[model samples]
Structure formats: structure tokens, C-alpha cells
Target chain A: MVVRRPGGRSARVRAAVHQAVTELVAERGYGKFTVADVAARAGVADTSVYRRWGDLEELTADVVITWLTRTSPVPDTGTLDGDLRTYAANVVREADGPAGPAVLRLVIALAAAGETGARAREQFLAERSRQLRTMLDRARARGEEAPEVADVVDQILAPVYVRSLFGMGPLTGELADDLVDRMLGTPGRGPS
Target chain B: MVVRRPGGRSARVRAAVHQAVTELVAERGYGKFTVADVAARAGVADTSVYRRWGDLEELTADVVITWLTRTSPVPDTGTLDGDLRTYAANVVREADGPAGPAVLRLVIALAAAGETGARAREQFLAERSRQLRTMLDRARARGEEAPEVADVVDQILAPVYVRSLFGMGPLTGELADDLVDRMLGTPGRGPS
Candidate 1:
């Protein structure tokens, strides 16, 4: 294999800075985190961090986007129901996992305030929605009839956010199955 | 009409305080605004506001509940699909209007943080869910078949919150129609 060198060091530095940012946001929330703090935690030079990211918001945009993008996988279970269950369960699992809802709320609140993080938030959702389209297209080929892919995707995923936010109910894998079944109109299908 | 006396004055004070809280939360957000600030803006005595509200969180809980309760009317449109269209469109319109997604994000963030406002957030969502139950119950009485009201309600309303928080596409009326149609399995129903 060819050895990669030129972009390696810079990529590693970016990774370190991002790790520091993620830890800080998860620990203390993103509102007051500073570039200097990230540099210290990352064990990189503050000047280098600043030079690469420009500022805290730019650093923050990347942190939010990376977390959201990697948290859910684009499942290819070969059918819409299977793919959607995987997809919905992934959304619930992400909501339940370590990053936690507080950080999520902070991101949404910032976007709602029309902050610079809006682009990051928008990019995050768009990527997820793209995966959903792929899943729906596969479903349609299998003779499923939901032409409104985005709308159906939102119905499957939004309940997780709503219930999570309201502290209303547990986000279980079963709930994910129920959601997909309801949307697809295939209730009581045996687990496949 | 029943003539109200002592309770009327107290109700008026509470309403004014809640109005001020809603405005302040919408204007400067939830973290910084105080009881004294609300009292000052509401033209009520600081002592009166403090004694009544106890803290910002109590006032905030009431504000969120009141706005959510009043924003939508339970539909009786003679068909489950029709009622759902009115219901889903109302959820979208509320997100698009004043007392908007920012306030919602703030409330959810507060609740997720395990603040006192968690009770308020819980109360607000419960009220909205209750309304959905009424509409769905009416549909059931008219011989519709979806018995899982809570599940179906979440399917319809949760997407509005998810899309709003993520700063996704506009919560358009057409999107609302698409959501109701997909959920209800009626593709080409005209307004009835």
C-alpha cells in the first residue's frame, strides 16, 4: 500500500482538536467552551487550533455535524420495514447514548437562535434524510408505495425526539418497531 | 355568567406574569431572564410576582403550557383523515408562528437538564397529547380502527418538533397534508 504523509499530520491534528471539542461539549455543554480550552485538552498548540478552525463556532459546527453523522448508520436490510426499524432504533439509541440530550438541546437551541451553527445542523439532518431516501427507494422497488419519503422518514424519527424532549416515554427498540409498522401499515408482521 | 371577584384579580396577575414570561423567554431566551425582569415588564409589583411564581422555572412552565394549549383547536372534521389534516397542519402552523420553535427548544433543553421546568415541559406535552386523544377518539367513534392513540399521536406531532429543532424544511401545510395522508393511507382525498 502507498504510504500517505502530506495530509496525515494536519488530519491527526484536526482529529485531536475535534476530540477535545466533543469532550468539552458533552461535559460542560458548548456555550462557554473556548479554543484555548480545546487546545489544552487536545494537547495541541492553541495557535494551531485557532489557525485551523478560525474560532469556537467553526470548531463547534464540525463537532455537532460529526457526532450527528456518525451516530446513525444507513442500514441496508433489503426491505423498507427492516431498514426503517434499524433506522428508527438507531435514532433512539443515539438519543439514549453518551452524548445525551442536553448537548442536543444546546445544538437545536443555537440553530433556532439563528446562530452560525445553523449550517451544521442543516447539514446533519440533510445527511440523515439522504440515507432515508436510499432506504425508501429500496422499499419502493420491493413494492412498497410511500412516494412521500421525507414525510415518512420524519414520522418515523420525530417521535423519538418529541418523547425524549418531553421526558414522556422510554425510547425502546420496540417503540421503533411500532413506529415503522404504523407508518408502513403492516401491523402485526412477525419479526423477520 | 358567573361573577368572579377575588379569583379574578389573582387570575389577571397570573396571566400578566405568564405573558411577560413568554415574551421574555421568546426575546432573550430562558437562561438569563429573571422574575424581577418579568415583574418589571408586566407592570406588576416585584414582590407580588415573586410570591406568586416562586422562581423563573415555575413561570416558564406555565408559559409553555399556555401557549401550547391555546395554539390548536381539536378538529371534528367528520373523517379521521380530515381531523388529522387539521391537527397536523395546526402543529406545523404553531411551529411557524410566534411562541415558536425557539421557545420550544428552550423548554425542552431546560427539561432535559432536569431543571424544575421539567415538570412544565411534561405538563405541556401531556396537554397536547390529550387533545390528540380526543380527535382520535372521535374518529374511532365514527368507526375508524386505529386504537393506539398515543402511538398514532406521536407519529403525527413528533415530526413537527424534529424538523423544527433541526432547522429542516419549512413546516408547510402541504407537508402536513402529506404526513396525514401517508399516516392514514388515503392518497387522494380532497378536503371534505
Candidate 2:
């Protein structure tokens, strides 16, 4: 891992604190956690946690943002249907992989807690939206889709988040492709 | 307006309790509010708070579930595109209405907090997904869309939730309709 050294000790301290926050939240839930617990778990000074972050919410946002940055970009397949299917497949792959469910559960958990948690959820969603838009724009530019695909993209891809967050149903590769093709209205293969 | 019973004390009490939970969550946030505070705000006996719900998380879930059930259903326009546009428009209307931002903010707040909150968030999404599926299925049954439209619907509509929860952009009537047409790939004066 490339260590961030610009802020030196502060950066190191922040990393430790963030790791602790994620772990503690996972283990105890946000309502049950405290800054003191985070500080202890991180093996850092309590003053450090207080000095670095105004509160746990800000700290949580930073940690999530950093984690999100590490996620891979959506693949380019030169076709809207192919691209969306690929994207949905990636979502499923991530969900089946290690950091996926944890982060998702964390977000859902936070959202359930109420306002502060809600803000964190919104921040995370905003970041995802920006990324999705970029991917969609690229596809549109590549002539993989009509210029008007953005609206459909939102509707087509919503099930993944719904599945991930709500545990409602399976979001598999086949389902993803089916969804994409249906929304695209791919001739005989559309909808039904 | 209409009272449930003669005394209607129980209904009044529930309403008061729900209102208190919403306000406390909005104010101090879920993290800071306790059962005692919720009871005090509702002007109910503390024992009642404990008796009615096993714990604070459960109480929060009840209040949220109640609120979600009250959200109006999307209309039937006898066409998939029209239905979706109406659905999206309805969602946008609610999201922008009086209770929209606050309730949304609250759900995100709790879900972000941790496991119990995550469970609550899942329930919230479940209700929404169920309602959405019902509407979509009816449209498909009417041959407005193919049988495969379920997945298509999932894909096209997921972005709105993604944007809403994440605070990405405005999901207005015109924008929603545009999205509906794009995902459905229908030609018209929809999104370019």
C-alpha cells in the first residue's frame, strides 16, 4: 500500500482512526459507539480524534469516501447494453466480494439511524451518482447509446442498490443484462 | 381529523410517540436521543415507550414504516412509459414536498449508523420495492411492456434511488419523464 506521507503523523493517525471507526461500527453499531472507543481501538490519543474530526459523522464520511475511491471504474464495452450489464455484473461481483456487503450494510445501518447518518448516506450516493454519470456520458459519446439514455440508466440500475441495501432479491449477471436489454428495447428480446 | 375510537387515547398516543421520534431524530439525531427523551417529547409514560417497542431501534423502525406506508401509490396510465414517468414524477414530487427532504434525511441518518439501522433501511427499501414491482407488473400484464420489463424497470429506476439517497440531483417531473423515455428508448420530445 502506498502510504500517504504529506501530513506525516497526522495522516498516519487518521488512517488508524478510520480503520477503528469502521471496525467499531461494524461490531457495535453507530449508536453504541463513541469517540473514546474509536480512540482506544485506534491506539491513538483521544485528543487526536477530537482534533482531527469534529465528530464521528465527519470521520465516517471521510472513511467511506476513501474506500469508494479505491473501487474500480466501470468498464467500457462500446455498447450501452454491454456497458450496463458489465456495470451490474461488477456490482454483483463486488457484493459477493469482501468490502461490498460491509460497506453496503454500513450505509444502510447509518441511514436507519436518522439525520446525521442520512447525511452520510447522501454524500456517498452523490459520489456514486457522479461516477455513474461519467460512465454513462462516456458511453453516450462513444455512440453506444442514444443521447437520451441517462434517464433510463437510473431506472435500469436502481434494482442493484435496492437489492444490495434491502436484501430483497438477487442481482445476478443475467438479471443485469436482462434489465439493460429490456430498457434498451432490444427488438424481439425486449421486455417480455 | 377523524378519531379512531371514543377515547382514541391509544391512537393519539401512537401519533404523539411517532411525532416525537421523528422530531428527536431530526433535532439531536438518532445518536443522541434516548428512550427517556422520546418519552418526554411524546408526553407519554416512559414505561409505555419500553412496553410498545422493545428498544429505540425498533421504535424508529415502527415510526419509519408507518410513514412509508402513507406514501401515495403511482397512478395507472395504461402504458409503461407513461406509468414510469408518473411513478418517477410522483417520487420526485414527494421528495420535493414538505416531508420529502426531512424524512429522506432521517432514513439515511439511521441506516448509516450501524446494523440495526441497516435492518431498518432494508425494510424501508423493501416496502418501496414491493410497491414499485406491483406497479410495473401491472403494466407488463397489460402488454404495455414485455414480461422481461421487471428487470428493465429495476435497471432504469435504480438510479433515482441512487441519486435520491446520495443527494445527487433533482428528480423532477420533466426530468423523470425524460428518464422514462430514454430507458424505455421511446422516441419523442423526451430527453434528447
By DockQ thresholds, what CAPRI class is model 1?
A: acceptable
What digit string (tens of lDDT, one per residue) describes model 2 on residues B1-192? 864667589888889999998888766766678889999989999999899887787788788777755764656787867667676676666665666656755665665566867777766666666777777788768866532434433544456555555455676777666556555654221122
Mind giving the per-residue lDDT tens digits that candidate 2 earns over A41-156? Answer: 99998888878777777778777777765664566787766666777677666664557656765665565567878777777666766777777788768866542334433544
Interface RMSD (Å) of candidate 2: 8.4
TM-score of chain B of each: 0.77, 0.74
Sliding window of 10 residues with minimal summed lDDT for model 1 chain A = A183-192
Alpha carbon lDDT at A52, candidate 2: 78
What TM-score would every model get versus the actual structure? 0.78, 0.62
Q: Each prediction's Cα lDDT score?
A: 0.70, 0.66
lDDT of 1 by residue, A53-75 (tens): 78777677677666666777778
How would the docking of model 2 be graded?
Answer: incorrect
